[model samples]
Target: MVMWWLSSQPKGQRQVVVSILPSFICWHIWKARNKAVWEGISLSSGDICHGIIQDVVLAVSSEVNRWNLLPFFDQFFDRLSEPPMPLQCKIVRWRAAGTRIATLNTDGCSKGNPRASGGGGVLRDSEGRFLIGYSVCLGVSTSLLAEVLALLAGLRFCHQRGFTQVRVQSDSLVLVGILQCWFQCSWQIRREVFHIWQLAEDSGHFSHCFRETNTVADILANEGLLHPLVQMKIYNHPCMLPQLARGALRLDRSGFPSLQLLKRTPA
Candidate 1:
């Protein structure tokens, strides 16, 4: 019926008329399914086909009458009898082929080697838009676990938001190596770490960065150590670190071990 109506319409309008039927049928099926599922009713395949036919017939008849094109109805019906060769198609084309994706920075801080820990993540788009910031407290666990958790959360958040590519910056070289498949770690951390790595791989692209460049996430992780409700808020404020603040940031580099696991203040 839709093809018939389109054929009877002016040549210039045929494409526009034919293009609308696919969307209309898709919506019609969706609504029918919703009604059946939510309204405690069931429709058979025959019933669905009948409904579609009835709708198409009514629509075609109404349009013909409204446009005073009854004289062309036979030709329209003849056109409807033939299978439609769709000239328009909707394709899933990539809009951001070479465009860079948002960058995510993440870090973990533990008060003890296998005790109270905290993790945080920060996301910034290619245009430098602050997309999301999050921090969370982890129960008794290893620093490795905390690090892995931080990466997991960041990747999960990005995946949920449909981010195709990302650079995940972190302070843990061990974690980065593990993610890059350059090191052999424990089975426990390896399992979760592998999952996170796979998630990044399934997406378009991702990379790791050093802690020096991941200050925002580092601060958020440290702050999480002091507050449990920190994750509920989004930090949109500009991140800045003075000399002292930079010094205060803790991670095991060479001489400096993570302050969270240290027994006393550094001299």
Candidate 2:
């Protein structure tokens, strides 16, 4: 019956709904059973369905923009009582590190979540002179894991090369939050995060930057996808990077600005 119902869903929604429906139903059912057994409170069928909807909403809310692109989710959101949110544009620029300190920027890319992932990082002195850069091909990994591994590699390199008092930056807000203990660490990347903390504990300072500011690192991360599996390459000069990446590095050193338009979230 469940399979038949799932198959009956609209073609565009069948895959998405099928992926989540079983887990949602099973989880809610288990919770309801526990509640009834322990507290002697029974949930009606409508109540159980409501709980599932709420769970689904919460699960996908973080990536609302992406989900809203899908026809099914777009219509689902349109039916909500809340008004559609407006968009906001803001200026973003790359800023140099403080005098006498080195800045390390890192980024990760995945063709698809858990597919063809890679990590990369670049270190530069206060004057924006590139000191070192590295790219790693991470096989069959999630973007979050790639980000964590990239950060760990950068921190480890700094520690080994005696680059104390370094400024660590990445475009991944969740990664920066994890390093600062502002967000809960997921089990998947907890171990790598531990290693990152160990290397950066005393000498490193962490910050989250916009993608515009971390262009070089982002480029390097994408380039890693073409590298051999489990391979890591180090570059000491801008010329060692791809042509476009070299241009981005030159602009970054010359204080060029990149603009990013972001939507304002409702308070």
**How good is model 1 by TM-score?**
0.48
- Mind giving the per-residue lDDT tens digits that candidate 1 earns over 100-138? 666777888888888888888777665544567767776
In each prediction, how many residue pairs overlap at the backbone (N, C-alpha, C within less than 3 A)?
0, 0
What digit string (tens of lDDT, one per residue) describes model 2 on residues 1-267?
Answer: 576545644434334555676799899999999999999999988788777766666665644553433334335544443444666676776776578888999998878898888888989999898888888888878888989888787778767778866888889998888889889999988899888877777523888899999999998898888886548888877789888778888898998877787866764
List of clashing residue pairs for candidate 1: none
lDDT of 1: 0.60
- Which residue window of length 10 is worst by lDDT in model 2? 65-74
Candidate 2 global TM-score: 0.65
TM-score of each: 0.48, 0.65
Q: Which is the leading candidate under lDDT?
A: 2
RMSD of each: 23.0, 11.8
